[model samples]
Target: MEAKVILIIVTTGLIWLIQLSSVEATQWHSKQLLPYFRRIKLDKTKNSVYQHTVKDAIRMHLRIPLMQKALCLPKGTKVSKHLQYADVSFALIILKSHCFHCVLQLSSDCLNRMVDKARQHENKFYARFTYACKTHAEYSSDCMESGRPMYYRNLRNLVKQTEKCWKL
Candidate 1:
């Protein structure tokens, strides 16, 4: 009986090991078959042009020029012109921030004016405005009100929430 139990355990262990090895082998084969490259192939005329991802491009745009200059890229690397668009909606009264627990109370009329100001302008590459909300506690006030531009945090959670006494 002891030998039978030992044999069963060993057999199960071997089967698991074999399955794991086969999975690793399959992953290796798949990676070799479809390798991912940071630099994708562009048109034949501009063979070596690699475009930065939108998020990275945004970061590079927002960052200081000295930091941007420190990083070197291929001679013709371009920021991807393709932009992702979203129609974001915020509540009329309470504003919930993504992090740092910042909440702003505003009236509906005031919120409408704020939204009007946030509208994208024609011929402008970027909008130059942001909304400011007060933090719940003194601890998160620093993050809510940073020296850097509002785009640095980018209002991670720009959603509406219902709280005690808020507007807009």
Candidate 2:
């Protein structure tokens, strides 16, 4: 009986080892086949062109004018007055959430490029604008009472810190 039990245990162990080896072999075969099934790599020039195309598409889609409308502010309206509107706060919150998601979809390289473009246009306001919208969206009443300019400057500084932390 003792001998029989030992034989049974040995048989089970061998079976497990065989199954493990078969799984490893299958994985090795799949690894060998991967390159054939994968997408072909683009040259650096082509890749950069594609990246720029995508970034421009995102920028066009996420233009600040669209966000301004969402915040219920007309194109020529003063930001201070618009900030006081009850709907402005709600819109800003929604815009901030949407921008957070949109930005996440973009690569850090793309964001850096966008920042560079904004700088070249003397539009340092882009980052500050987004930050202010998000901050006021969060604390609408308090932000209005305390002052929009102060919050905007503070948020802009925060945006600068965040940009500094991003990988180049």
Instruction: Tell how far residue 82 is off in model 1, in angstroms.
Output: 17
Instruction: Tell me the spans in candidate 1 whose CA falls farther than 4 Å from its real position.
Output: 36-40, 44-168
Query: What C-alpha root-mean-square deviation, in Å, does candidate 2 show against the real structure?
Result: 22.1
Residue pairs in steric clash, candidate 1? 92-168, 93-167, 93-168, 98-157, 106-167
Residues 1-168 of candidate 2 have per-residue lDDT tens digits of 999999999999987666555433323332332232122222254334333432343233223332243332334443432222343444444443333212212234534543444333222222233344455653244434334344334434433443444332
Please write out the lDDT profile of model 1 over residues 12-121, one tens digit for every residue.
99876665554333233223212111122222432121112223423343221111111111223342232111101111011121111222333444334323322211
Residue 81 displacement in candidate 2 (angstroms): 46
- Which residue segments of model 2 deviate by more than 4 Å? 37-39, 47-168
TM-score of each: 0.24, 0.26
